[model samples]
Target: MELADRVQSLTPSSTLAITSKAKALKDEGHDVIGLGAGEPDFNTPSYILDAAKEAMDHGQTKYTPSGGLVPLKNAIRGKFERDQNLSYTNSEIIVTTGAKHALYTLFQVLLNRGDEVIVPVPYWVSYPEQIKLAEGQPVYVKASEENSFKITPEQLEDSITSYTKAVIINSPSNPTGVLYTKEELQALGEVALKNNIFIVSDEIYEKLIYGQQSHQSIATISDDLKDITIIINGVSKSHAMTGWRIGYAAGNENIIKAMTNLASHATSNPTSIAQYAAIAAYSHDENEIEQMKLAFEERLNKLYNWITSIPNVSCVKPDGAFYLFPNFKNVVNHSSFDSVDEWVKQLLEEEKVAVVPGSGFGSEDNIRLSYATSLDNLEEAAKRIKRFVEKHSK
Candidate 1:
């Protein structure tokens, strides 16, 4: 049987591959502590769940507009205005299956053959692969640990060429859990504005911030820049609604319309009940959000302290998000193990801990460990990692 040439260009997400292996061990009655998952461990908040239930009871289980229902769009608009200080009318917003889908749709709408997307190294596993699947090239602008895993405006400018179509900015970024400061975002925005390139800001973790700092969306900096920015956000991380799969994008009306048209022929609409749940999520109590933020902060502190205890492991304490992208280079090439993948595989096989290797995220010598598990499990996972590193560090 023949297969598409594109399939040869794609790789399975290493994060999910490790996750599946860990799940298989757990099913076989092993006590595997999985710290690889990217989603929050918390259940979807009760009010949001109740909203979904009520929607189902009220017979709201039909198809919706491909972009989203009018109320959800309006709620999303209000959210952007109140939170990010970016205003978007109904035509400028579209809700999709998840932020991933929102991004894939945007790539489909925007990319042509030979088009390039500048993605920083240590990127979310899907970004470059998705770009390839879209028939666009992903040009990675590598950032070092010295810069706290952030790509500079100069790097952004340098990566741009005549065929460069967009740059992806994942604030409170996925693997590194690094949040770009307002100054940095503005600087990058300046480059995008100058080059007349689109900026796809993945602000999915905006509501999950840990410290005193708040999220500053790039589009909010200026109306002039807003037209070229696509803000991808969702309820998955913040509200612990990964299964609900409700995500949205706000940007220029033309792009939104294109994404919606693409979605209509693809997904038709995001789940109707989930959309209703998202309405509650966007309009829910501030207190619930505050409580979740506090809990995440506590977990972040626990993981940060524990990571430092590992002999050669060091991590940046993220201002937001539930991940700690620790550098284990000292143990990587120096280890008895051949590669980071081998080290992680041995740990999963021996210590019963599951973590995604940094190589999977474009950083070969580092690894990402999520603290979105239970407090007890986080403690155990950290303990296992520390032991593994110490034994392998020679």
Candidate 2:
């Protein structure tokens, strides 16, 4: 059998592969601990779940609008105003299956065959792959560990060319959990505006922040840049509704309409019940979210302290997001294994702990360790990881 050339050239997700391997080991009677997943371990809030149940009971299961239901869109608009301090109309938003799908649709709608997108190194694993799948070129700009795994405006400007179509920014980023400050975003937004490049801001982890730093969308930093920026968010991470698969994006009216048209042909609309649940998520009690945030904060502090105790492994102590991207190069240099991929494989085999290699996120000699698990599981995983480093480091 023959497959399309596009599909043939793609690589499966490394994170999911690690997760599957861990589950397989567990099934075979091994005590494998998984720290490779990107979702919050918390269950969906009861109010959101109740809303879904209510939607089902009311027989609102039929097909909705091709974009999304008006109520959900309105809810999303309200969220932008209340949270991000950015306002948008219903027509300016497009709801998709997930933030991943919102990004996929944005790439497909905006990129042409030879267009180039500037992506920072150690980015979310899906960014470059989705760009490739859309027939656009992904140009990677490297950022050093000293910079907290974030790219500067100078770095971003150095990567631009006539063919540059967009720059993708993820704050409280996956794999790194690094959040860009308002000053940094304003500087980058200026560069994007001057160059006429679109900015794709992935703010999925906005609500998961800790410490004195706050999450700021690039669009909120500048008015001139607003029309060119596409802001992607979802209730998955913030509300712990990953399985529901509901996400939305706000952008220029034309771009949102174009993305909606693309979404119409692709998935029609996101799940109806999920959309209803998402509306509740956007409008739910703030105290419930605060409780969830506090729990994550407790777990994050525990994991950070445990990880810092291990020699030769240093992390940024991110302000947002539930991940710790530690630089493992001191222990597992390139010469230690054939590649980061092999290093991760050997670590998984030897320690029975799952982590995603940095290669998947456009870097080497690092690994993304998610803290989105139970405190007990995290403590145990940290012990195993520390032992693995001690045994492997030269």
Candidate 3:
């Protein structure tokens, strides 16, 4: 049987691949310390779980409006207004299975064949694949590790072509965990506005900042930018609700309506029970979010310190999110490995410590390590990694 060309060209997600491999090793009785898992280690807060149970008990397990329940939309609307000072009507929002699904569907509705989306390198693994799946071209613009793995407005401006349709902005990004500052977003928003390109802001990690850092939504920069920008976010990371799979896009009403219509023919609607649970997530007390953020910040600090202690390994301290992207090229070369990908495989096989190869994220010299696990597990993983470095350097 032949697979479609779109499906054939797609690569397996490195984070999930590494995580599956680690799970396999563990199932085989190895003491694998997997740092590739992207979701928070914490259980979804009890309140949200209770909400789900209550929803099920109340017979709320049927299909919802294709766009989302109005109350859920109101909850989401209140969230944006409270958190980012951005407002959108029910007609301007579409909730999907997850933030990942929202991106996939948005591209399906936004792209024509041969249209281009400017995707910064070291991106979340799915961006390029999703664009290609929609018959759109993904124009990669490298975001240098030196600039904390962020791209500049000049770079974005230089990448635009007549076929360019939209540019992705993933702040507190998946692989890098770096936040774009307000001034930075303003400049980039200006470029997008000037070029008449839409901005797709993926802010799933918006609530997970550390230290003095803050998350900024590019849509909140101005009304014009908001008009052209689509905000992608959900309860997955912020509320430890990854499995619930409730995410949404807020933007132009036309785009939202099109996505809703497309979804009606596709999913019918996001899970009804999950929609009610997500309403509780946005409606009720959010103290659990702060608690998870504090735990992640602590783990990030310790893991970042431990990983950076290795000889020839360096990392930029992330402003938010739970991942540390450390450059190990010098370490790889010094350890006699030909490539970072091979080094990552050997490290997993030999030391049983799993981290994602950055090649999958478009960087051949780095690896992504998630700190969304217990401090005990992280400490052991770091020790094993340090031991691997020393052993290989010998």
Q: What is the C-alpha RMSD of each candidate to the true structure, in Å?
A: 1.1, 1.4, 0.8
What are the clashing pairs of model 2?
none
Per-residue lDDT over 276-342 for candidate 1, one digit per residue giving the tens place of the 0 to 100 score = 9999999977687778778888999988998888776777778788888888777776688888778
TM-score: the better of candidates 1 and 2 = 1
Worst 10 residues of 1 by lDDT: 310-319
- Off-target runs (Cα >4 Å) in candidate 2 are 333-338
For all candidates in order, the CA lDDT equals: 0.89, 0.88, 0.93
Scored by lDDT, the top model is 3
Ranking by lDDT: 3, 1, 2
- The candidates, ranked best first by TM-score, are 3, 1, 2
* Per-residue accuracy of model 2 over 83-166 as CA lDDT, tens digit each: 878889889999899999999999999999989999898888889889999999999998778998899999999999999999
Q: Model 1 misses residue 56 by how many Å?
A: 1.0
Stretches of candidate 1 above 4 Å error? none
